[model samples]
Target: MSISVVLLGEQESMVRQIESYQGELIVTRVCSEIAEAVAACLTAGAEVLLIADAQQVPLMEQVDELLSQGTAVVYLLDGSAAISPMPEVLQLPADIAMSDLEQRITATVRSLKLPEGSPERDDRETADLEPRDKGRIVSFWSAPGSPGRSTVALNFAVEAAAAGRSVVLLDADTYAASISIQLGLMDESASVAQICRIMDSGSADISRLNAACSLVQVGDTTIRVGTGIPRSSRWPEVRPSALRRATLAFKDHYDLVVLDVAPHIALDEQLSFDTQAPQRNAVTVEMLGCSDDIFMVVQSDSVGIPRALRAIDELEESHADLQPKIIFNRVSVSRSGRSPKRRLIEAWDRFGPMHDVVGFLPNDSAVCSASVLAGSPLLEIAPRSSLRMEIRSLAGIKSSNLPKKRVSRRFSKSA
Candidate 1:
């Protein structure tokens, strides 16, 4: 069977050359723009899309969309322009001889036809690659108000690292990039933004990605930190696709990847006049969707509980498979009366989602304040604090990093 193909914005001369060529590839449509070409490809069930460089440059930002639609995306590069090849997209010289073009296209199509994870496909891609394990991605998400998301994420990563696991904490909160400030890294350059930009250029690798992060030694263990945008206005630079790509790449290097994402998870961008417009909350949504595990940090207060429950409903509707493990922050008797933990558990059992609460982080204002002021982890200041112990438990550190309980000796009775 002839391989169906669509041509977008090709010169008439090139079109004539292709038309006169003898190959199994058959052109189904010629489009002036990418949108029309994509629609034509989808409607006609075209197996391949060949976009010329002149047309591809203007819509380069939308290239991710083109490569993602289950059709083979190829960029015909003319002498007038140069383009990089992504892992999935093919880049061929526009002035290639028909025979060579036919050979390359046939080979690419055959490869694309192979089933994912088949021995043939795996050998072709990974023959030279060594075996490696993918890291677990955990995202700390919360409602609009400050619910200790960053605090938990930072500590969780540190505790995991303290347990001898390789970890990287990514501050993905585009709205409020506070991890950098909290960690006291005064660098003006944003590490996460730089990493995303590198991914967008199709040049991201383990080495390049590691160079973009801040490697800090927490206790005896070291954990990498990918700081967020220096300014909130720069959120657009961290495109959703690029961030996703970067996070996936992180899996190859770290054992545990922690994401501290923004509170907003709404996908209201579709309501805009321009459907292709950049989404404000897309970063958060993408992180949540990509996370292997999501920890919903709900503040222990009147306003926070209601907001969290409502947010739960929204998340369920949007992300159908998402069942976040709830972690109530600031569990205090001041707010929930005596037996705060029991009350919070009962309330969640009554009104919250089906999953039981994962853990509760106790409110310790003095330790929190001191750690923030000192630009250090809470465990560093108060090693035996209840809050630190709880976080350690949440991180699955069975052996306590906290000091052994002190036993008091009284001289009273004999004396």
Candidate 2:
């Protein structure tokens, strides 16, 4: 079968060289710019896009999007510098013999075209299979206040681990990462950042995650903690693509992957300036996009409610299909007025989006404060606290230690 192709390059020499090639791959269009080339590929219904110079592409995110649309990309390299291998992208030296390049292209196209159940396709599928018991990634986010997002996430992970599920807690907040300090592990190195760096270098594996993480034990359970960046100024280190890869690696190795991320999810930086520039909140945004379940925590106050409503709007704009469970933290009569939970529910139904409030963590100032001061999860610091019990219920963790209610032995027989 003849493969449709679009050729792109920054330099005239490289474009001229690729265009002069004589092969079965038909070059339908030649574009000097990234956007133009991408548009041409879609409009012309091309199957393959051959980029002579990868450096010319400003936004790697755009390349990812194109690849998602099922267009095969071939990056022709001048061999000037080494680059990490990107998934599904073919890279070859531009100086290779045209005949050799043609053969490689034909082979790659043919492999991609192989019908399902064919021996080669089946073999590849068998090799690519992930473990049947893959883990779930759940993320907790808030509206940029001390809404107890980190606290909730930490306790939830502990509860999950205690319930016999292998859990990994990831601190993915780029602006302020407190999981390390919260867990009382004051190491300067950030495991999440280190894992992202390793992923970007194309060397990420389960061993890398285990090596980068710190093990924290609560009761009889141990949780692998992926600590966040020590300094907020180093947000650039956790790129979106790398973070996604790291999260996938975590999911493959654990039964539950819990992420605590920053409140910011706006793409303002990408829209206002050069799209290729690093995004400050990209880590949080990427986690939101990838997580199977998202818990949106809001403080039960006038200010917190308004802020959370705005956050919901933002989520609607960015992730239309996301049905995040709304959780109210620090529910109290003083802040939310009389009958706090009921009143808060009424207000949310009237003012907020369609998403219903999932659960409320009641105000336990004494217990929460003590846990913070002690640098421990509530499950360990105050397992019987109301806040802890609520969190346990929310996380679906059942404890046999709960006091049973006395049943009235005298039952009035209606019969």
Candidate 3:
């Protein structure tokens, strides 16, 4: 058998993956509380004490005590680059595939010398981790420039939270990361980069994920907000596997996983004859891959409309699996001369390839500016404004028409 695991804190998804995997790992005890986790070591005979949250970083001493007793410590961290106080111990990403994470954790522990008087050790065959459910991931993206992707994502998240569902608004945009600025958050602390680090760290659980997510109020709705890359240049740090796991983990923690993704699909390393190298724009595509529903944000002006339609056509061709709902933002009814919706639909049906348009959002610069200035959602700044009404209408449509994932029972026993 592999190492016995004494899991602590909340991350049912991670726990389920570990236990369900066909490995030598036997989970002797799984504790929901941190105290239980620290104390479980003494009686459970577990060789590995796995803490799911980086937020419990203060528990280093207790972890060390376990280590001194020969219990291997594996902390799943949120993407923060904070070095572990004990370097010899294993640190794994929370959102990593259970099979991959298990192999790494077990192999690493095997390589480490068993401490004096320690006994929790097994030398059996091992493998990696996979994934499971949490909730439906809704990702919003746009073409080259700003199509209010973040704004729309923020609105949807706030509206969903206001409707009594837990919502997480994540800014994974590789281009001009702007959620911190849009929401007026001065603390540039938790970004996707940090979360990626945690997922890569192999110890990330709900607590560490939440530690990386800042709670912000949008209107009366309070929701979790995951910041984006501090700078566009830091895009290389985000990996597709890490992002998938992080999103899956976030789904477990929240009712809705709303991600604002990057704009392009460009590779980061193409020359490495390996051909499997990471790409910078994988941020957008991978999010699309995981998304249950995708909203392709687009402007409604003449130039913007044609560009967006072409982009949508291209997306349909490139990502056949993704049925992205094209959202035409900023349409001026009067300027269009005739019925804007009718004209657009007619044009879309004839010229566009996919021709699937969600609907049109009215253009209102005054209201948009007001919301930005107040650092509030459109509902708070100008609830009756056309833009807010359209977005709110879309939110209602989502609640009514979209299928939401029911929470999985797999984590109940372990969580």
Candidate 4:
């Protein structure tokens, strides 16, 4: 009996090579869209998929539905593609028997289903639900134009770590990459893009995770850090497939995973069957989708409050499950706007139901600047800073008083 396979990822040379290897076996359809690949698998009963783009591996769940009917999938992992294999990963030559490849893929999919104690199952791509032990992912997502999202994210990771939670901080801000410079991590190449690259190849493990993450020590507490894209234009590197896998792997290891994300939420909708890359905003949306908690940081001013409100409205429209806690940052100390917090609350109340003010941080530029210059968090560099204390209180907030999450305005407020 011959096995059926579908080819994707637009790597025509690789696809042709695969076709040659299969000989008389069935090639159901050469598809570009993953959805089409799924349709091909179901309609034609393709037993395997030769995926060229490791970035497309997030389609695993959709593909897994096909697996129950004996379909197995694996990324071809050719070195010629955007993802380069590690020196240790030996490549399968073109002459390898098609039967040998089928056996390998069958084992890979089977291993993905067994318990973690099984050596073969360990570090494999298990997409949907991990055990209850999987950690929480908290993201600091704000509107663009420097609203202190990174600062809040870094501080939150530090606080979480200090509270004895194993934490990993991911700088995922694709637009204005700053986590590396802010932490004085001089190694430009040790960013999260490397992790994305490895995961894209469908082979991410503890060894790779350790290589991608940097450790920062605050007294006895340690926070693992994954730097963001060093350049904004290089958006293609952190594709959704890579992003989803890396986050799932980290969640498996740490008690808390923190992401400092970009602000935009646009999805690239184009007229091409091979448009696998979601918009640049796709990365941020992916992070939000995976995160267990979100802190929507906003500046406490007329311009900032209105902008933040608009952002929430937009996010709510697109994502129905967005119950983000609104954190008002840089509360004024000059007493110019008497009862600014009160006024901010009153303004939001009129718009619609709102999440209570999570907490407030003072405008302490000197302290934050000093900590950044020293390549340390305020907890270590300026423990006495008013900003640090406020953040501490913010982190220690009881969940019951977390302010009831309510629906936003019936309609969006004008920009």
Candidate 5:
């Protein structure tokens, strides 16, 4: 299939440069009015929209509206141009020059292309033949330096399982393979390595995968855990396609699939064996791209607040559509020397208004100590802890907010 695109700008030279591309190109010239340009692009069936430097600020809103319409956009910026303070509002990848713009447009188009006999389409065709009762996927992620992502993910999975939901906790963080070590399940007998090997050979059956999974029962909840690779470099072997397929298979067998992805952006590699992959500073974007909702967890401190603000900007740049729910972990009323609510408000005021303060987890030494000793979730080890209650309340809010009819319909269709 040929690539279809629409170029929006007043610069005739830039439009001509895009017209020079090798593949099938359809270019529409839009002058000053941003709305008309966007409407023209949409009417032309342009899958990718390229905005040149000549476009005005109002053009950004049109870009946003196009994105909402499912059109991938690439912004062309001058190499020497001074970046605006609010660059996050322009939620498209910025290209420094004509070549960069060309590359991004091509990449976006290539990624969106449907492969021959696409798996998703094929799966939908056999929807009646396969089990459809596959449950929801709740993924957990946090900023780099230990915002308690794993702990929260593990406990949330445990709590959901305890609520009579069949949950499978997947340790998708390839950089640090700590879930096994944390749960004392790191043994030669069962690991994700074997599963990866099976998948690498293109012979990973459901039975083989089930055989590799280690089941850990806590109280009334049964959890199947998937371990990560020992080293971060091995992540390339664990392709996102494979991870997605594995999750789909798990969804068929479980009621909920809780994923713990690494606190990094997903990147592509030409060779499957690259040791040091190119890291895109857009991790938040990558996570939001794949997630239904995002829970941004931050420690209530000076350093944490600053980092959260930076992370929010990066996330907004990648996914302006995602409104992340802010979770204040380790919030201490006395530590702030004033009201905790007041401090939180101050932080929000300084950072941005795109975040919502959903809940706060109190700093509790007992909960931390119990988690380390028991190698279990805080909810299991310290059920009465204030931290546990806060986490439970957050989980309850998520559960209550979920549409009952939608869940039932999804499950019924799967069944």
Candidate 6:
């Protein structure tokens, strides 16, 4: 009863097989090659793609592209006399024999069909192919004292930019106004206060905000740094709305936006009692809530695990949707202290399903000292440090991997 189509291989025999089942078979277009077949299939609005045995390799290369276009594939293998890789072909979930493939193809078509008279589907049908212009917000935060959240954020942004992605590093830690000083870019003018004020007034747009941001060029990478306000009283101006607007502007202009958030809420009078302003805990909540991904930094020690656990609990309570990846910083393999990995495993056994542990970095004093003194990222000051390599691996910024692209459909109305 459903319309079926075949491409490129013994079309007459395929049509005969479809007619044998008393089903409507339409070979609206035919081509000698895979590319032409794909184009024909797209133009014909074919729901099921029937690729013969010889055309599998070329078809596989375009799997993602085809899937993005909302077409499901059904590979039709040759019925051979004992000398082919039928097992391998069958292993693929999409491939199936023509004799038994009709029902499966019909089901796939039905599943992909848009609901009749559905507004959502109609909106998606008319939506643009380009992804919604928004910057990817990645936040770094840890428990009390020092967990190197700023260092991780700074270096990660640098590494991401070095790998050829436009990046912006934001210092959202209101309690500590030291990023500008730490990065050696400190000056009376290197402040985010004015930008926050303008954004709060609703007069600042993305272009204007970008122009106000400071540009820091390292090697071939360029990064925009948002220095924190000098006084904690100015946090009201740096509320979530302001931060969100700033990052939205950043995303429009940059590939990645990284936020270095303060570990705890600032209890200054301006933020504590202002009813109109964001609550004291708002910044932490906003950062964790908006981040596409979060990195939880922790020291590898007895005290550190308990502290990390508390932070996790707080994060779960405030931002239930956030699933942070834990990175055990300052890990030592020698039996000099408690094993960081063992401690992490114990935590995982109890709360493993809640959080993901991406990787661990060893305690390298040289790297830390170099970062502090030079006011530069670990990769630039101490490229040979084991910590640097670990960070690179965790961030997936290696040159061997293909650069990540913003999948257009990821932002579509259908999603």
Note the residue pairs that clash in candidate 5.
132-414, 133-414
Task: Give the per-residue lDDT of model 2 (tens digit) for 115-228.
Answer: 523688445434435547788999999998889899899999988887889998999988788887777777878888788767755554577668788887777668888889
Candidate 3 residue-wise lDDT at 212: 75
lDDT for 377 in candidate 3 is 74
Expressed as tens digits, the lDDT of each residue in 1-415 for candidate 3 is 6688887777777667777886867777878777787678866657787878666553433554565566777878777747533434566766777777777777656644553223433231112223444677999888777777888888888778767788878888877777777777755554677777777665557777777777775544477888887766677777765777788777766779999887675444566657345577777877888788888887766677677766776676767667778887777776454788777777667876674688688778787787788677765666556676677678774323221321111101011
**Residue 296 displacement (Å), model 4:** 0.2
Query: How does candidate 6 score on lDDT?
Result: 0.63
Q: Give a tens-digit lDDT track for model 5, residues 1-415.
A: 5556666667777566657754454564554566666777667667776666533444433544455455666556665544331211232334445565555555555544544246753443354354446577676766666777777777778778767788777777766657766665645333455555555444436676766677776654467777666665555455443455466566667777777766555344435545534332232234344454567777777777777777777556655676667887777876554788678877677765666788777878667866766676664566666676677677772433221221100000010
Ranking by lDDT: 1, 2, 3, 4, 6, 5
Candidate 6, residues 1-415, lDDT tens digits: the string is 6564645554566656566766545555555677777776666667556665444334232433354455666555444422222111121222344445666555555545665325654454334235666658888888886867777778788788778888888888877766666566655453466566555543435655665667776554567777787676666557555565566557667778888887774334454454433554567666776678888887767677678888778767655667888888877765224765776677666853457788787888777876778766665566656777777777786634422331111101100
Evaluated at residue 319, the lDDT of candidate 1 is 73
Winner on lDDT (3 vs 4): 3
Q: Which candidate wins on TM-score?
A: 1
lDDT of each: 0.79, 0.78, 0.70, 0.69, 0.60, 0.63
Quick one: how many clashes does candidate 5 have?
Answer: 2
Candidate 1 C-alpha lDDT tens digits along 1-415: 6888888885676667777885687887888877888778767767788876454542434556654455677778878674543555667787788888777776666666786436786565444357887889999999898988898899999889888899989999988888877777777688888888787766756787888888876666678889898787788888887888789778777899999999888877779756566776999988887789999999988888999999989888877777788899999999888999999988888887786588988889888888788777765666788898899999999754454433221111110
| Root-mean-square deviation of candidate 4 | 11.8
lDDT (Cα, 0-100) at 252 in candidate 1: 71
What TM-score, over all chains together, does every model reach?
0.78, 0.74, 0.63, 0.68, 0.60, 0.60
Stretches of model 2 off by over 4 angstroms after superposition: 1-24, 27-131, 271-275, 402-415
TM-score of predicted structure 1: 0.78
**Where's the lowest-lDDT run of ten residues in candidate 6?**
406-415
Global Cα lDDT for candidate 3: 0.70
Q: Candidate 1: lDDT of 158?
A: 85
lDDT: which is higher, 2 or 6? 2
Segments of candidate 3 deviating more than 4 angstroms: 1-133, 272-277, 397-415
Residue-wise C-alpha lDDT for candidate 4, range 1-415, written one tens digit per residue: 5556687677677656557866544566787778887777877867676675655553433543564465666556545545433211223433455677656555554564575345555445432234567888998988766778898889888877877888888888878878767777766674577887777555657577767777776655677788887866676677754676688778878888899899888674443437343467878988888788898898877677778877888898888677788888888745217776776677668873467668777888888888788777766777666787778787773323221222111111111
Highest lDDT, which number?
A: 1
